[model samples]
Target: MVASSTTDAELSPTVRVLDPEGRDIRFVSALDPAGVVAHGWLRASHRAPDAERTLPYRPWHPHGRLDPLTPGAAVPLDIEIWSTSVVVDPAGHRLAVTVQGRDFEFPGEDPWPRSYGVDTKGHAIFLHDDPDDRPTSVFGGVTT
Candidate 1:
């Protein structure tokens, strides 16, 4: 019998949020950076229903108030993209990020100012206001 194999790119990648206890958190969508500069946002598609069957639904507020380090303070979380994950720590010195099993670390710095929230349908929505001159949507050639 012939054997078949698949590369990391061929497989569908998943974006996951892990709580401090290492438990997976359920989210509708996530903001995927278009590039290193964070000029725009790319909608991340949720995994197939079969893949998410085992995951539990846990709501999280990304815009909640944050306090300095303390015993009961906000828990640090790790955002996983595909085979890689990054421990998101505001006070950490290094930002670890891996994509498709490739290391992509950078110096810890302030993140871009962008708004995101969950929609009525429980889908994560990234609020991006395009410039007046730029096209609103990538398809249909629609412009502002």
Candidate 2:
């Protein structure tokens, strides 16, 4: 008799948004289909209490040049992926997703989230609700 085992690496890159099983993950973003497709970055961090770690991406406006996401140095439990096309609906609006699986959603009218910011020069930056923390630059490269 022979025994075989399948590893995580053996699975396909395409993630099933909705599975027959109950296991699923959720994400929030206001990015439209094009924006999501262009700059979709997800990550999981203790810093983010609610959002699990996922890949990271940048959002770009329509008719604008797309920017590459700044890669993190740490390894993730799952592989990081970038989208090739921003899925859209018949109305031409960015398809909003809010499923309990590995998908993204837009939280319209919700409070701002705590996130790290990066500048063009590639410096680390944090957001502060208080005016006191406001500085000349968001990061070394991004000046507010």
Candidate 3:
């Protein structure tokens, strides 16, 4: 199993399954029906953990506080991957854990129905289209 980040501002928080019957994994994005499994990430400033609620599998963070990032410095950030139920057959399918800069989208027509009242295409209602907020930025870049 191999995983890596393409940028400094990447989301990461791993998982462990002790199931005696255990055998698989993948790079699934959150809300991606392609094979929805689990995903999570926290803003760098919101990485403060709630010590009392922290656990081995899941690390809880309190959003009440914000910590500014130090330029050109590396910091540890904890993430929480929302759990899901999926059956994976290692022999037939390869598990892919995607760690990318943007949200995942359906290449063709949206398989999700709009009448259902959710993002049939991709992304939440955050509507990060405002250029002023710099929706297209990354860490250690001129933008971000």
The TM-scores of all predictions, comma-separated, are: 0.18, 0.17, 0.59
Tens-place lDDT per residue, model 2, 28-116, is 33422112222222212111221333334422223223222232223222323445443333342333232121223333443333334
User: Compared to the true structure, candidate 2 yields what TM-score?
Assistant: 0.17
Alpha-carbon local distance difference test for all models: 0.26, 0.25, 0.47
Clashes of each: 0, 14, 5
Ranking by lDDT: 3, 1, 2
User: Candidate order by TM-score, highest to lowest?
Assistant: 3, 1, 2
Tens digits of lDDT, candidate 3, 56-98: 8888987888665554556676677777666654454544455
Stretches of candidate 2 exceeding 4 Å from the true structure: 1-8, 15-76, 91-144
Q: What lDDT is obtained when candidate 3 is compared to the true structure?
A: 0.47
For model 1, name the residue pairs that clash: none
What is the lDDT for 99 in model 3?
48
Report the candidate with higher lDDT, 1 versus 3. 3
User: In candidate 3, how many Å is residue 122 off?
Assistant: 5.4
